[model samples]
Target: MNKHIADTKNNDVIRPTQAEAEAAVKTLLLWLGEDTSREGLIETPKRVAKAYKELFSGYQQSPEEELGTVFEEVAGYKDMVLIKDISFFSHCEHHMVPIIGKAHVGYLPNGSVVGLSKIARVVDMFAHRLQTQESMTAQIAHSIQNILKPLGVAVLIEAEHMCMAMRGIRKQGSTTLTTTFTDAFETDIANQVRFMTMLRSGS
Candidate 1:
């Protein structure tokens, strides 16, 4: 799990009640000049509260535990295992708007391998939270490196943030790219090039 995320769990904080959360949504609607009493908006707060539970559920997940079960029975296979273009939806921590993206994750196994879906699940555990592309990339890479103890981990994420697309300058299609490399990938330029080559080849 990421350090910032883990800190929140260890810290003393009072979480708001569901009704309070709904009330906050109602306040936002009112601020937007939408009458909560109107038929169209009457149930929106409740619906939003429910939707938020699912959207930000990553706080309740443990990435370490998700990658805990690994298989060491590979037939002497030691090579790069890459999963590319895994789609994810996250909200920017700054503006609370959608940051839609895909992640490319790769790692060199030491002597074992994790289930392929587990890699996707790890991505979700980080994505289903308020994040920045840079921080999220580092978080995913660190979690795999720490838990799986792989020879190296690489995470590349490209995202279009709604905060940029829907507001400010309103550049709708601009994308942000962030990458993190650990262990062997960090030390070896050739490994880094290989990861990027593999990623570009597939695209």
Candidate 2:
């Protein structure tokens, strides 16, 4: 665990115990007029609490630490290294509904390169939290740029928010796209076009 994550205000707040979390679920079930003593519902609260722990495990992780290791012996290969079509699942902070998406991460190495899988793990770390797609996109870009000190970083995410699809308006199949660029990518328009071209052409 990173010291930064350990010292955050979120960690400073006393967290509810598992039993307490299950109790809250039971309360919600009661509010929904469900009979707690019924066999099908008896273990639902416990199961829900367990499920939530896994679903939101991102809060327990540190993206900085995950992207910390870098290989300096990349034979001086300092071009855009992109990992595309990396699937992810997240929950919307507002409605707690699922956000199914694919994240495309790219970075220009500054002499060294981080492990390819590390980039995907960083995406998973953020996706396991309740998020807005826009915020998650920036977080991924900044984490790579700040930790790797890359020449530039670019993140593009295309997601379907279940909050809109399953509830309000109930329109399905609509997707949201978000992007963030930093350093060279932000300052140079040609780099942006190259990135998008590579993405679209699947090169």
Candidate 3:
């Protein structure tokens, strides 16, 4: 485990314990007119608490640790390395509903490259948190740029917010796209175009 992970665990001391979390769930169920003592609902609070533990597991992870290992031997190959169509599931901070999406990440390595799976793990770390798509996109790009120290970083996310689909105007089949670019990807139009082109090519 990384220092950051350990620090996070230490900080978790202030958060609710499993019993408290379950109690809160039961309170919510009772507020919604559900019988907490009913056979079917008796264990619902515990189940919900367990589910929330998984849903927010990202909080237990550290992006710095995930991207800590970097390989400097790239055989002098320097261009753009991109991974596209990386799927993710997140929840809206306000509504706590699902935000299903795919992330396309690219970076220009500066004599160092990280493992491909690290990029995906970075995406997962941020997605598991409750935040808006735009915020998540920027967080992913910044984490790469900061940890990998690449010449540039790019992140694009396309997601459908269930909050919109399940309520509040009830728009289905609607997708939200958010993108973040840093360094060369932000200043160089050609770099941006190349990243976008590769993302569209799906190859």
Query: What C-alpha lDDT do the candidate models reach, one value each?
Result: 0.92, 0.92, 0.91
lDDT tens per residue, model 3, 1-203: 11222235566556766787788999999999988998999999999999988998888888889999999999998999999989999999999999998999999999999999999999999988898999999999999999889999999999999999999999999999989999999999999999999889865
All candidates: TM-score: 0.94, 0.95, 0.94
Those runs of model 2 whose alpha carbons end farther than 4 Å from true positions after fitting are: 1-9
List candidate 3 stretches off by more than 4 Å: 1-13
Model 1 scores a TM of: 0.94
Over 1-203, each residue of candidate 2 has an lDDT whose tens digit, in order, gives 21222325275756767777788999999999989999999999999999998999898898878987899999879799999999999999999999999999989999999999999999999999999999999999998988899999999999999999999899999999999999999999999999999999998
Write the candidate numbers in order of decreasing lDDT.
1, 2, 3
Per-residue error for 195 in candidate 3, Å, reads 0.5
lDDT, model 2:
0.92
**CA deviation > 4 Å runs, candidate 1:** 1-11
Error of 3 at 59 (Å): 0.7
Could you give candidate 1's per-residue lDDT for residues 93-191 as a string of tens digits?
Answer: 999999999999999999999999999999999999899899999999999999999999999999999999999989999999999999999999899
Backbone clash count, each prediction separately: 0, 0, 0
